[model samples]
Each structure stands twice: as C-alpha cells, then as structure tokens.
Target: MATRPIRMFGDPVLRTRAQEVTEFDAALEHLIDDMLETMDEAGGVGLAANQVGVTKRVFVYDCSHIEEGLRGHIVNPVWEAIGEETQIDQEGCLSIPGVQKDTERFQTVKVSGQDKDGNPVSMVASGLMARCIQHETDHLDGILFLKRLSPELRKEAMAELRNAEWNQEPRG
Candidate 1:
C-alpha cells in the first residue's frame, strides 16, 4: 500500500458529492488500501474517497486506538445519530490541511456500510470516534466541518484561512 495525494480544500472535486460504489472490484480494493495508507501517513483517523480525488461514497477509518480494538473501513456508508445532538468539538480535516475548526456533532452514531471484502457491516460509535466518523462521512457528501461552524466563528476563520498554506507538508 502507498500513500495517495490528498485533495486540498479548494479543489472543486472536494465540493462535489461522491458516487456510490456499485461494483466491489480489484480497483475498489486497491483504493481502500491506498486510502488506509494515506490516512495513516497523514495521521488522520478517517478519510473519504473525495479527499483523494475519487468521487465515491467510500471512506476508511481506524478508531481502534481511540476505542481499543474497534477499527475498520466503510464503503458506501450511511450513518444516523443515536440520540439528540451534542456539544461542539474542535475538528480538523486532512483535506483542509492545517485548518481546524469547532463544529457540533452527535455524541453517538450508528453507521452501516460494507467492508473491504464487500461484506455488509454495521456498528455504533460514540464520543470522539463518533465525531470522527461524522466528520469524514460528511466529506463524502461534499460537506466541510466549517459548514457546521457558527457564522461569527466562520467569519473570523476566513482571514486565517486565506493565509493558510494548503500544500505545506504535515508538521512532524
């Protein structure tokens, strides 16, 4: 597996909704491996297909470190909240590069999707793991965490965003 280039925030592809994967073929499996490598290299908990310039409803995540031994991928995934929305947490994205912002998300979530082998799987996640899932899945739908930010905060972040460097190598 090799790390794939991540599409930056301003890329038009990042704003376009991803297409669902209909055929679980070799190429799809390859993409999943590449995505896992990419996410690992970038030190991200989750990554979406759109973030890698593939417009597909595919995302990979490994929250095992967060929840201890619970980790996997989500291809053509769909998610729903388990309860009422919860407080805001500061979230960051690999697509947005160095930028980070606060956003509100459900504290618990139930997601359904296929595994790398195309086997159907469903699981519930909560806390930071849940937030990460929501954030990454949103990217597949062309949604950014900044979209969930407060108007005032978003306005303030714009200036910083303008000055932010998108192509900078991740800090060690």
Candidate 2:
C-alpha cells in the first residue's frame, strides 16, 4: 500500500462531511490499506479518509499503547459518548500539524461501524483509545479538533494555523 499525502488544514474535503461507503469493494480495501500506511508513516494515532483527500466515511487507528485500544479501519461509523465523566488533555491532528491544544473528551466511548470487509464491528474504549476513536470520528463528520476548543483557544488555534507555512503549501 502506498502512503497518501495528507491534506493540510483549509482543504475543503476536511470540511465536507465524508459520504458513507456503500460499495465494500476492492477500492475501499485499497484505501484503507493506504490510510493505515500513511498513518503509520506520519506517526499518528489515527487517520481519516478526508485527511488523505478522500471523501469516504472511513478511518484507521492504532492506539496499541493502551490496554483496550481499538486498532483498525471503521467504515460509516457511529460514535457516542459513554458517560458523564470527561478528561481534558492535549490533542493534536495529522491534518492540522504543529499545534496541540487542551481538549476535553469523554473518558469512555462506544463506536459501531463496519470493517474494511463490510463486516459488523463495535468497540467500547477508554483512555487514549477512546480519545483517538472520538478524534477520528469527528474527522468523518467534517469536524476538526480545533472546533472542539473553547472560544479563546479556538482563536489561538486559528492564529497558529494561519501562521503555519505548511498550511499554505499546495496539496500533493
């Protein structure tokens, strides 16, 4: 599988909600494989299709450092916050690089989606796994971690994004 060039911030595909995957075919498989390779090469915990300039509702994650990390691609995922408990921690994204800001996220989450092969898949995870899952789900919905920041933090994040030279580079 080839490592796809990650789309930077301001890319329209990242802002547009990815279309649900209806065909579980060879192309989908290839995309997932490429995404996994890209994520690994980029040293990111997760990578979404939109981050790689594909508007398909799919993401690949690997949070093996956590005990119950959910590692694999989820197609057309539906995620929910599991409890009232929350954790505030620094969060970063592959698309929006050079910025890590404090973000609040549910400590536990439940996600259900199809696998690369169109098989049913579900998982309940906490800690880094949960955070990664939620982060990636947000990408599929045309949302970024920057949107989750508070007003002041969001403003600061916007400024940081604007000042990043890489953000102005042409999409490869």
Whole-model lDDT values for every prediction: 0.85, 0.91
Which pairs, if any, clash in model 1? none
Error of 2 at 163 (Å): 1.6
Per-residue lDDT of model 1, residues 1-172, tens digit only: 8889998868899899998888898899999999999999999888999999999888888788867866567888899999896868788888776667778899999999887678998988898888977988889899988888889878866666777876445879
Q: Using alpha carbons, what is the TM-score of model 2?
A: 0.94
TM-score to native of every candidate shown: 0.92, 0.94
Which number leads on TM-score? Answer: 2
TM-score of 1: 0.92
List candidate 2 stretches off by more than 4 Å: 168-172
Per-residue lDDT tens digits of candidate 2, residues 40-91?
9999999999999999999999987565445688999998989789999999
